[model samples]
Target: MNVHITLAHPEPTSFNGSLTYRAETYFKRAGNNVTKTDLYASDFDPVERGAHYKDRSNKDVFIPLGEQRAAWKNGTTPEDVRSEIDNLRNADLVILQFPLWWHGPPAILKGWFDRTFPSGGVYTSRMRYDEGYFKGKRAMLSVTTGAPEEAFGPGARGGDPATMLWPLHYSLHYLGFEVLHPFLAHGVQGHGYSYEDHGKAECRLAQKLDSWEDRLAGVWNEAAQSFPGWPDWDHRGQPLS
Candidate 1:
């Protein structure tokens, strides 16, 4: 399978980076072609500018200002962002690897979505509220969190990690990607914890990669099950059942 892994953490030696490296290694070892997009290393621009839309044919093309404004407030769009979008368009699976910063993805990764997922980019405005681009793709999040898993449970340091992930889940699902259970590594900041520990965490991560490899190689049955019909709403907010 052709896979693309996008890493957003800045530190090369950080736990997030370590997981990305391991994931890439495992994917390749499984005989899959893997492409890596390190956001920070690539210096991806995160802000959107007027130029992106300045060339619109009509001054009143009915661009969704609310959505465009939201993206701009986050960051500027990178010049080479289209290449990343194209990668997603062609990939069999996409893995987003990042650190849990303030209970969300790092800004760079979020910016990636802002630019790559707008109308006329990946999904069109008419299809935004229905099934859209990326209709048959598969995606997963590989995250490293500094806090313990308990801290993210109900009524703890925050709420459930799954709750915090709703937007991400809905976004990918709306774009027609089959969502996989995330691979999360919690307690990275615990006492004596290190990315190179070569201990239980590493072993567990390896096991997770093995499972992920198997899943990626499997036929995309979930996509058909979730979207039994085309252009209709499924439980995941897209068309299927």
Candidate 2:
């Protein structure tokens, strides 16, 4: 199987970095061809603007959706966008690795979605949801948080993980990727602010890394997390009751 892992953290020596390294080694050992995209190391620009559209449909106006559609149709899409899309096309599984910041993924990853998934080429109004472009592929998020696991719950201190991750997960669903349940690493702090002793915290973090490896061993056979599809909605996009 072919796999692609996209890492969005800035620090190469960080825990997020280690997890990516671990995945690269593990996937290769499992006989899967793996491709990696380190956003910071590669200097991926997170901004979407007129500058990216070299051969614009309308020179005076900068409508992102319009420009993307036109560029794709004209074979003038940005080089970076084209390359990322190519990587995605060749992969059977995609792993998005990052440290949760401001309750979501980094800006670069967000921009990756905005740019790489071209409007006219990859998705259309009637071609989305269950019938999306990358239908048979699978995707998952591996995220780290600085707060302890116990601090997270409904109305808890660290906020609800499910709710926080909904948008990112839904976006994958939009692309027709069967999204696996996310792998979360909690209480991951660069400093000693995670409310745990040094030795215990290190041990716990190590355990989490090991568990991640174990989890991925059978992830391909695991069921994709269910989400509402076109069959569940009506013409007005309301839930069928």
Candidate 3:
């Protein structure tokens, strides 16, 4: 399987970076083809400009977005964004590794979505709504949190992680991907957790990955059964399929 791992942390030696490294190693060791996108190290542009709007009607309008996303799936896109897109497009699974800063993905990763997920870039006009270009893909989040797990519960100070994660879950679900439960390492930076704690964290993360790997693959295969079209339903209506 082709798995794309996108890292969003800015610091090279941070715990988030270490998690990404371990994830890559694990996936590769599992016999899957792994591609890593270090958004910060790549100096990716996070700002969208007038050019993005100017070429809307041009025949090559989708070119830039396509180039930016080329590497995502399997190197099928052209040399530009194609690498990133190919990585996304051809992957059997996509693992997003990042720190839960301010309760969401870092700016650059968010920018990646903004730049890549255009109306015609990934999803064609007809395929909008329930159907998306990335339909049938499987995605998982591996995040590191500075706060302890206790702070993320239903009645805790930080509130439920599920609530904090709704945007990401809904986005993937809207794009027709299956959302797996996130793997979170809490209290990584807090007092009492020593350097040796990282080893335990790694083991926990590995166990989570091992437990979900087959289930995620199953979800991807199931997602592929649907046509690339919106179902006959509304927000208040029941799911058609």
lDDT of 3: 0.65
lDDT of 3 by residue, 26-120 (tens): 66777788898998998877665435342243345455554333323333332325567778888878888877888888889777766655444
Off by over 4 Å in 3: 51-80, 125-130, 190-232, 235-241
Model 1 poorest ten-residue lDDT run: 220-229
Q: On residues 71-137, what C-alpha lDDT tens digit does candidate 1 reach at each position?
A: 4345443347657877888798888998777878888988887766665455654454336677667
Tell me the spans in candidate 1 whose CA falls farther than 4 Å from its real position. Answer: 51-79, 126-130, 190-241
- RMSD value for candidate 1: 6.0
Tens digit of per-residue lDDT, candidate 2, span 1-241: 9999999988888889888988889999999999999989989998899999988888998999999999999999999888888889999999999988999888988988877888989999987879999999999999999888998878998889899999989999998999999999998888422458888987888888899899889878989989898999999999999
Deviation in Å, model 2, residue 213 alpha carbon: 0.3
Instruction: Please report the TM-score between candidate 2 and the true structure.
Output: 0.97
* lDDT order of candidates, top first: 2, 1, 3
TM-score of each: 0.73, 0.97, 0.71
How many clashes in each structure? 12, 0, 30
Output the worst ten-in-a-row residue range by lDDT, candidate 2: 189-198
